[model samples]
Target chain A: MLEYVLSKYNFWTYAILLIIGLYAMVGKKNLVKKLIGMNIFQSAVILFYISIGVKKGGATVPIFLGDAHAAHGHEIIIDAAHYFIPLPHVLMLTAIVVSVATTGVALAVLILIYKRYKTLEMDEIMKIRQDTGA
Target chain B: MIWQLDVIFCLFVIICAIAAINVKDLLAAVIILGAYSFFMCILWTEMGAVDVAFTEASVGAGVGTVLFIAAVNKTKRRSKD
Candidate 1:
């Protein structure tokens, strides 16, 4: 049991992090806290994808080392196993951009909510809404 | 990848994530979140994802923290819960 658990500790850590993020999103009463939870959740997901692309052997980044023109006289052999997978990284680049964009838009909406409601707490906002019947 | 360093960085990341959400002060929480992002970048670099690390450093730690701080400044800093 110990060996199995120790070997896959990274997955365990990510799972714990995901749970924390989810708890914050659901249990937190403040809007900013919920936003922080969302960010944490997104990070955990990106981490999971990056971890998935990792290999257990001698592997480097997926980038060409030598120039193609310099090796024109001889055929260059590329080994797939020698490098980390690039697909997850490429997909995560877009995810990171989307995360930031979501953050910015959420913050803007938060500011607007604060402006109208004069508070950022969920309960307070609900109270105001019910009082105003809106 | 160094498993020891990975474990250490993961510990810090988890701590930062918990602290960031639990802190009552909005500004402090935002700063802690930045620290979390920075630790995450380091972790990614250790895991052999250099490009992801760079992007996380620039965007997550840099711009995200700034946006959160600005929003906190414009609004209330104290969280009731």
Candidate 2:
């Protein structure tokens, strides 16, 4: 059991991070802290995806470095084992961009919420809404 | 990729994540979150995801932190809870 847990420690770390992020999102009363949690959650997911592409024992980034014309003149054998899987990296790149955009939009909405409610606390915002009968 | 570096980066990332969420000051939390993103970037690079690490460094640590600080400046920095 100890060896099994130690072998895949990356996954375990990410799981802990995911749990922390989830707890912050659900348990935190501050609006910005919830956003921070959301960011952490997104990062953990990205890390998981990137980790999935990792290859052990002399694997490298997925970039074709050989000359295309030289390969055309002579048959060049490509070994899949030599390079890391790039699909997850590409996908995570897109995910990171989307996460940033989402953060920007969420922050804008948070600013508007603060402007309207005059406070960033969730309970205070709820009370203000209740008092105003909105 | 050195597993030792990976483990160190992971440890730092987790610490920063916890600190970011637990801090009462919004700006400080945002900055700690930036540090978390930086550690994550380093971990990605150590894992041989150079492009992803670059993107994370720029987008997650750079732009994200700036936006959060801007929002914090525009709003209140204190947290009751």
Candidate 3:
């Protein structure tokens, strides 16, 4: 029983952290609060990916040998290095770029909203727009 | 390895999703929606889809949340509640 518990502790902890982030994101009202929750959620995902990529006594992939163009460069045959995946790294790079683009677009939209409404409160803005019919 | 943990996590994800949709406050609902992404990321990780988890984390949690907040800040916080 102890062995089972010990072995699965990591999984349990990971789940708890993940849920905590999710709960915050799901239970908040303030826009800023929601953003923070989302950040937390994203961080949790990064952690999960990194954790999954880790393996006991495993070497990192993409091994680099002697200079490729050297006179006597060594030929390095890169291996999969344990079960830790490298696919996540590639995917994460793409994800990061996409998120940055999204953030930029989102900020632009927010700026436009501010210009049109002059307020950040959703209810207040709605009321103003409804009253003005614009 | 006990598989029940997956069930537990799934339960939480379901709760969060429901809260996201059912919350009266628009801002609150957006936040809950963000939570839904976070739980989904965890689910992906557990499924050994580390790449998918990473993508979801960055897009769903980071950019998606920021966008929603920006939209909310420009508009209102609540619809009914």
The Cα error of candidate 3 at residue A83, in Å, is 8.2
Off by over 4 Å in 3: A1-21, A65-79, A82-84, A126-134, B1-81
Cα lDDT computed for each candidate against the true fold: 0.92, 0.92, 0.60
On TM-score, the stronger of 1 and 3 is 1
- In Å, residue B68's CA in model 1 sits off its true spot by 0.4
Proportion of true inter-chain contacts also present in candidate 1: 0.75
Compute the lDDT for candidate 1: 0.92
What is candidate 3's CA lDDT for residue B48? 54
Model 2, residue pairs in steric clash: none
Fnat values, one per model, are: 0.75, 0.92, 0.12
Q: For residue A97, what is the lDDT in candidate 3?
A: 63
On a 0 to 100 scale, what is the lDDT of residue B45 in model 3?
69
Better of 1 and 2 by DockQ: 2
All candidates: TM-score: 0.96, 0.96, 0.48
Kindly list the per-residue Cα lDDT of model 2 for residues A1-134, writing each as its tens digit.
98887688789889999999999999999999999999999999998998899999888989877887777877788899999999999999999999999999999999999889889999988898899999
Segments in model 1 whose C-alpha atoms lie over 4 Å from true places: A72-75
DockQ of every candidate structure: 0.85, 0.91, 0.11
